[model samples]
Target: MAHTIDISVVPPPLKSDWNPPAPSGNSVSPLVERRLLPAGPAYLAHVKRAVHKLTFEEHDKHVEAENERLGLNGTGANGEDDLGVGDEEEPEDLLTLDAKEWKKQDHYAVLGLSHLRYKATDDQIKIAHRKKVLKHHPDKKAGIAGDSNDDGFFKCIQKAMEVLTNPERRRQFDSVDPHYEDLESEVPTEKQIKNTKDPQFFFKNFAPVFEREARFSRKQPVPMLGAYDASKQEVEGFYDFWYNFDSWRSFEYLDKEINEGSDNRDDKRYTEKKNKSERARRKKEDTARLRGIVDLALAADPRIKRIKQEEKEAREAKKKGKTGAANGLSAKQKEEEEKKKAKEEAKRKEEEDTIARAEAKKAKAAAANAAKKARRAARATEDGTPA
Candidate 1:
């Protein structure tokens, strides 16, 4: 941390009539020390009350002095409401109830320049403020019979002036203009969701929303997957993209201004620091909102599971085909093996037929030879009596 030193010079105390006694050597108890403090009936908490009282006391004193200078306090001790000389009324209109609600009010509407808020120049804003003030100034009711309180309409015009004259405040307000952005009103409805159940229809209708919200991420675009035939990995990727979506949306344009009536650099810096913390808190809330959207889609959408089942069946069929190809014989190889076996069988059958023919011819020749030999022996036995 950088070391800070107080460079401010302390002025010497004035030599006034009141003089305080120095405390004796420090042997006193805290109770006595606390009681002996010259600040009468004071505590640490009393200091805060003193600050509040001092601030309001100075403001009231200034008002009293101003009214006296202007001779407008004729009824000062009478405990009556002022007749509109130096008094300003704060009406409890809905928009004027809180100072911060100034942001919500259409400043353009407040200034009666609704059609020219963006196109109007700084001179135009000044002129409009002046004209509105002249018409609504409480002093204008001097000749009127009754109370002419318009219920704080003029204060809103002043509020508009404070906002529109400053360039930074005006720019920030323009970014959130209801007429300009109107994002909240464009939220997806149940009817729209049902109508866009088809993938192409959903993309046509709803892609613009997610794109405008966060698809500007250089990493990846988290688009809608509105298909029942989407794969398992596609489903996983879709959820992953949404869950870690890096939205380009920012709270910068809506950030609180540090320049609101800030008199010094230190005060401005303190306001800036406080506004930055609030912006961080709002950004955290926006991120949580995006996360909730993703969670809701994940839980309610049925297309991812259906697509996952489809992808699984397709994978199984593809795997089965590959397995069949791996386990079965090739067509050409099987045909060649069949041809070789048929050739071997034909050759073996031809050889067996040739052997049978040879055996039969040899037996017939032997029988004929035996018959001839018997006839010769019988002819020889004709003389040798009966072969």
Candidate 2:
């Protein structure tokens, strides 16, 4: 039995008489009609409706097959011992289920959160979902089995992500806007709800939300690689904190203190000893690694050996006040000198501009005051007031 499905027909917009591109390839009935192209957004609508129809058809076949398998089609009717498979008409297909039945399995309720009765920030919804998932995840607890555990939690997360990310589905489901509007009204077309039940949708939706959260929330600066120089103290500090475990431990303690209402840990000596030993070990390892690399490179190249010998000889000559053509300045010294000069010039210009602006502002104020006094005196004489 096919239930009466209310399929509202929306006409093409009146402003432009554009036709959709004809369905391509060999086919009996071209899936999309060419008449509905002008309304570009509704193109997705047409596709979704087609998909829904196909899904319903497939579901109808499945129900019929199941009924046959269960002997519900009178195959073993009337006193036949059919092993309790019950010779009754198959329960109505999914399409036959009324709106009330559909409401029982609402996608929003599955997420363990209230359906939106009003607008809310995505963060609020996300927090609610996280709490719900944590409560329901069996791995986090114990003894719970089947759908109430990880599987159900994951399904709910997926559904919520799908419904929220798609503007059309959310608006329609939330009753903020009707799925079908007045045919001739100025109602904009919606993107059709996709039929994907895949987990990939969750990740795709999650990335956008994650990016939004990271962008708006003030986060500790992340250190980037290749930032090396005097001008990058903050960058170096960011990396230093990031690479050190103490920063992470401190953050964890702070979070615990905020949430749990206390922070009292008395084990200090052991922690200090452990941290100091770890740092010393790491530094020693790094030094050995660098030294091994240098030794390997020098053994592989005779030029490095000659260069070191020449450098040592040059330093000795310089100490003895014997100068040569290649001895004016080293690259490192020149770079440092240039940096110092630039810093001094920048500071000098800043101070000069500061004084200049201050003096100009003082002069302008004095001139304005003198002009105001003259205007007041002229006004007093003109009105024959006491002057």
Candidate 3:
């Protein structure tokens, strides 16, 4: 075992940038420099051959380790746990979603942010998108069963990213979010609220709904639906605020797509007209819905009746005091009574003005209805029909 080894036959140690030499028989070189290796399939294949290969499991573990090292494996920017072990399996329908029909897709669900929905911040969305890409990229899924050229879910992720990254587009999507629609559908009806025996039911149920709706308000610090014991002013202010709510919500997201590849100007115009009409209809319905909520809240408010009763009692007490202390009051007391009377008179005048305005509105409506009926009658007579 002590025989001398032949040192002359050993090749010189390769430099740091050394590359393998081309085969002697072949005229063309297959040994591409590492810098130039990514340019073509042939060069890439050569590079792969020179590298040590890992099994699929080992590759996945390597990727996971890299992700962890990069701080991409823990909680997201919004402080929610990253989509991992405990997340629900995606639905078959979601997996099969057509990217072409992106308008119909739930972008938040596609990005695994359904629980957060519109509340999910931009950073959170980005993190979720990246996680999805890493897990479901086509290259990563190579050799996996049922994987195909049609990367429907991946395409959905890209579409979702495209929409949610743009502020205007995200707002449009949020406006008509189906999650909100579901929440609205679940809101207790006016009849149900009115019939509930529990005194706290209104506050308990409607508080959450109003809070949810408040997010759409253009104005900040939205007034809340207060508890049963809330002050008269507090209750009145809440109703007033909601009744005149200026919402940023719009129906542009639900606009119907123009027929694909149809370049006819008339067709485009017609589609635009329909979309505008639909937007108006939806806006009107939404306004009515909000008005109904306010109306119901006003009708159900216990504070209004209590305040009215207190006002009546105070009025009666003042009357009794005035009658009983006809000539026995001090100068200060007289002055106080005079001020109180003046204040009451001003309040009365304001109430009368409000009533007058209401009466005028009714009269105007009646006149309009009478004019409409007259027009219909005249038209009927002209057509030789019954007036």
| TM-score against native, each model | 0.41, 0.18, 0.61
lDDT of 2 by residue, 194-279 (tens): 44454344334323322322221224553322212223355345334433412111111111112233343443545555666665
Q: Using lDDT as the measure, what is the rank order of every candidate, best first?
A: 3, 1, 2
Compose the digit string of candidate 1's lDDT tens values, residues 94-191. 32434346666777766656656566777667656665677677677667786444436667778878988887777666645656455534545556
Order the candidates by TM-score, highest first.
3, 1, 2
Off by over 4 Å in 1: 1-101, 104-244, 252-271, 316-340, 354-387
Relative to the true structure, how large is the alpha-carbon lDDT of every model? 0.65, 0.46, 0.82
Ranking 2 against 3 by lDDT, winner:
3
RMSD of 1: 23.3
Candidate 3's residue-wise lDDT over 1-387, tens digit each?
A: 699877767788879998888779957868866654257855564555457475556656766786575455465446566644213358788888888889988999988888788888877888788887876677777777974633877899899999999999999999899888888866677789668898778778778889889989999999998776788788778888998999999999999889999989999999999999999999999999888877877777677888888889999999999977875667668899999999999999999999999999999999999999999999999999998
TM-score top scorer: 3
Query: Which runs of model 3 end up more than 4 angstroms from their true locations?
Result: 1-89, 147-150, 327-387
